[model samples]
Target: MEVSKNAYYLVNDVLRAAKLYKLPSLAQLCRERLFSASPSSLFGGGVEALAGLEEIAEQDEKFSDKNSEDDPHKQVEIPGGSARTLNDDMKFALSDEVWADTVLIAEGHRIPVHRCMLVARSEYFRAVLAFRRSSTHLTTEAQVSNAMAVVNVEDSYAGIVRVLRFIYYDQVVLPSLNRKDAKGDSDGVEQEAERAEGAVNDYLAEEASDQLLEDLVAADKYRLERMKRLCEHAICVTVANCLEVLAVAELVHAAHLKQVAMRFVQTHLAQITAREEEFRRFQKDFPPLLEELYASLRDASREEFLLRIVH
Candidate 1:
C-alpha cells in the first residue's frame, strides 16, 4: 500500500516510458517487478568517516597559513616538556590528528562495510573485484611456476597496474615524455641521438631478439602507439645494420607486423629502387609473402586498399 521514494520514482519512470512507447504491458511488468523486489540498506560509516577526514584535511590546509602567521613563536608544548620533538611538531603543525583518527576508524570499519556493500550491489563492483582477483590469481600462479626467474621480460608491475586500471575504468595513466635534459643545441643533436640509440641498444640487450619482435607484434595488435613506435625504430635500426635480417623478418613478421613492415619497406624503397637487380632478386626470394600481401590488399575495402606496383 505504501511505496518508498525509490520505488515511486521507478514507477513514475515506467509510466512515463509506457506513455511514450504506447506499451501498457511494459508498465504492468515494471510494477510487478517492483512489488516482487526486496530492499536492503547499507551503513556508510566507513565512507562517512573517510569523508570527514578529507573535510578536516581541507580545513587544516585552508587555515594553516593564518594560524602559522598568528602564532610564530607558539610551539605545541607536550606534557613534561623535556623538548618538543619533531613528531610532536609535525603533528601540531599539520593538524592531522583528527584526520588520522578518521583514517584509522575508516580502516577498521572498511572491510565489513565494503563486504556488505559488495553483497548488496555486486553488479556495480563485480568487474572491479573480478579484475583484482584475476590479477592476484595470476601473480600467485606466476610465483608457483617461478615465472619471474624464467621469463626475461621487462617486469613493470606499475605499467601492468596502470593498464589494468585503464581497462577496468577507461582511464589512461601515461608518464610524461618531455626529455628536457636530453635536448640541447644543434651540435648536441648528434650526442642526443647517440644517447637515444644507446638506450634502445641497452633495452634490446636485456630482451631476446625474437621476444622483442613478438612484443612489437603484440604492441601493433594492441594499438599501443609509443610501444609501436619504439618497435618500429628498433626494427629500422636492426634493418639498417643487417639488410639481410630485414629481408628474412619481412616474411616472418608479414602477418602480425604488416603495418610496421610495410612502413619499413617504403622507407628502404629508394635503396631498392637504386639496386633494381637486387630488388627483383629480393622479391623473387619472398614471392609467397608478396602474394599474401596482394591477397590482403584484395580482401581489403576498395576505398582503403591500393594496387600500385612500385618499381
Candidate 2:
C-alpha cells in the first residue's frame, strides 16, 4: 500500500515491533518505505537530509561568500524557511563523579541527570527546568556553576527508573521474568525440565506485555513520543490483552494505541475475548470496553443472520 501520513508516523513503531518479534522482512519493508518517502518524513530523516541541504546551500546565491571566514548567514534554509541544523543529540560527557545538574526524585529514589539532556529531550522537562532556575531546588553539595535542581517525579520507583533510562539511553530493556531459578538444567543429574522452562517462558511473555503497558503510561506522562509509540506497538500486537492495553491507552490519551485496540476488538472480538475466564478478566478491568465489544459482536451477528434470511 502507498505510504500515507499516518503510515509515515507508524514507520518507527512498526520497525520496532517487527524487531521485537524477530521479523526482519517486516523491518526491511518499513525501512524501505521510510527511505522511499521524502527526507522530510521524520525530523528530516535525521541525517540523510543533511547532505541534500548542504548541496542546496552551496548552490544558493545566499551562501556565495566562499572567501569570507565568518558568514553568520551561512545557513541552509529548509522547506519551512528554518535554518537546518543537526538534531543535537546532546551528549553529556562531564568528567566529575557527581556532575549532574538535575536530580529527579521519583518515589523518593533520587537520580542524577544532566539538565541539558533532559531539556533537549523533553518539552515537559524543559519547562520544569526553566521553572526550577529561580527556585530553591539547588542543593548545597551541588556545584553552583552547574546550577543543580531537584524535582520530585510522582511515579512508581521502577516505572520512573524505566522512563529515565529511556531518556538517557534511548532505550530501556524491560525487566526479565523468564529466568526461573527453581529448576536447573539436566545432565542425568536432573530431568531436562522442559515443561518448567516452557511455563517460565509463558510467564515472561505476559510480564513483558504488562511492562509495556506500564511503560506506555510513563512515556505518555513525560511526553516521550517515540518511546510511547514503541510501548503502544508492543501492546497493540497482543490482541488478547487489548482490553487492558486499551484502558491504559485511553487513560494516557494515546490516540494511535486506542485506535489499534478498538480495531482489534471490533475485528476479532470472539477470538480475542474467547475463554470465559479471560473474558471475565477483561470485564473486571475494563467493563465498558467489554460491553462495547460484545455489542459490536451482537450487531455483526445480527447483520449476518439477516443477510442469510434475505438470501
Candidate 3:
C-alpha cells in the first residue's frame, strides 16, 4: 500500500512499524519515499542536515588543511579546567539530586535528572517536559507546574543510566572486565595467571557483548545517534556478539552496523553455522534475517562462480 498524503510526514515512523510488523512492501515504499527526500528535510534541517559533510570535507582538499590555520574551530582555546573537567562536573550533576528538577523511573530505580538538561539533550524528553499553556495569551504558574517531574521509562535501569551518562558527558562507557585471582598455590602462579586471564576474557566476551547490545538498543530508542555509532563500532570488534548485533542492527535500522555484522557473519559463517543451538535460535527468533543471510550467501556464491568461469 502507498503512503497517503495525510501521513507523508510520518513515513519514517510508518517504515519502522512496517519493519517491526514484517510488512516488506510497505517498508520498501516508505524507504523509497524517505530516500527520495533531501537530507535537510529528512534530518529536520540546519546543523543536522550537515551530518555527513565531514566525509565530503575530508575528500575535498579545498575544504581541508589549507584553510585549517584560519579555521575558527581550530582558533578556539580552552582557557580553564579543560573540557574533561566540564564533562566530569556534568556527570557529577547527574547524581546530584539537589539541583535536579525531574526524575526518570526505570526498572525500579528512581533517577533524579534536570529538566533543562533533558530539554537540551533529547527531543523525546523535551516534548515530555514541555509545559502546556491553557490559553494562547497566558500560561499561569499552575500550568507551568504541570511540566513533567517524574517520567516512567520502560528501558532497564542500566540502559537508562547509560543513555543519561551519554547525555551528561557525551561518552559511552562499557563495563570493564575485572581481573580475578584464580585459586592456586605459589608453585602454580604462572598457570593461575593464564587461567585468570582466560576466564576474564570469556566472561567479558559474553557479558560485555550482552551489555553493548542493550546499550545500542537503548541508544537507538532515545535517538542518540552518536552513542549508537560508538556502540556499533564496539560491537563490530567482537565475534561472540555478531549475530545478536546483526539482529539489533537490522531491528534498529542501523545500516553501518548491519553492514559490518553481515561481513562478520560472512567471514565466520562456518564457525557460526556449526553451533546448532545458535543456528536454531536464529531460525526461530529471526526467520527473516536468517532467510536474508542465506540469500546473500547464495548471491555471493553465484558471483564467485561467474568470476571463476570468466577466468
Best by lDDT: 3
Pairs in clash, predicted candidate 1: none
Per-residue lDDT tens digits of candidate 2, residues 58-172? Answer: 5432323531334444332344654222222222332222667778887777777788778877878888877766565556634444565788888888887677677766875
- C-alpha local distance difference test of each model: 0.44, 0.68, 0.74
lDDT (10s digit) by residue, model 1, range 161-201: 33223222333433333333455568789788779867866
**Model 3 score (lDDT):** 0.74
In angstroms, the error of model 1 at 65 is 32
After superposition, candidate 2 runs with Cα above 4 Å error: 1-97, 134-145, 172-192, 236-240, 263-287, 302-311
- Greater lDDT among 2 and 3 belongs to 3
Worst lDDT run of 10 residues, candidate 2, spans: 83-92
- The TM-score values for the models, in the order shown, are 0.25, 0.54, 0.65
Question: How would the candidate models be sorted by lDDT, starting from the highest?
Answer: 3, 2, 1
Candidate 1 ranges with C-alpha deviation above 4 Å: 1-159, 171-176, 181-257, 271-311
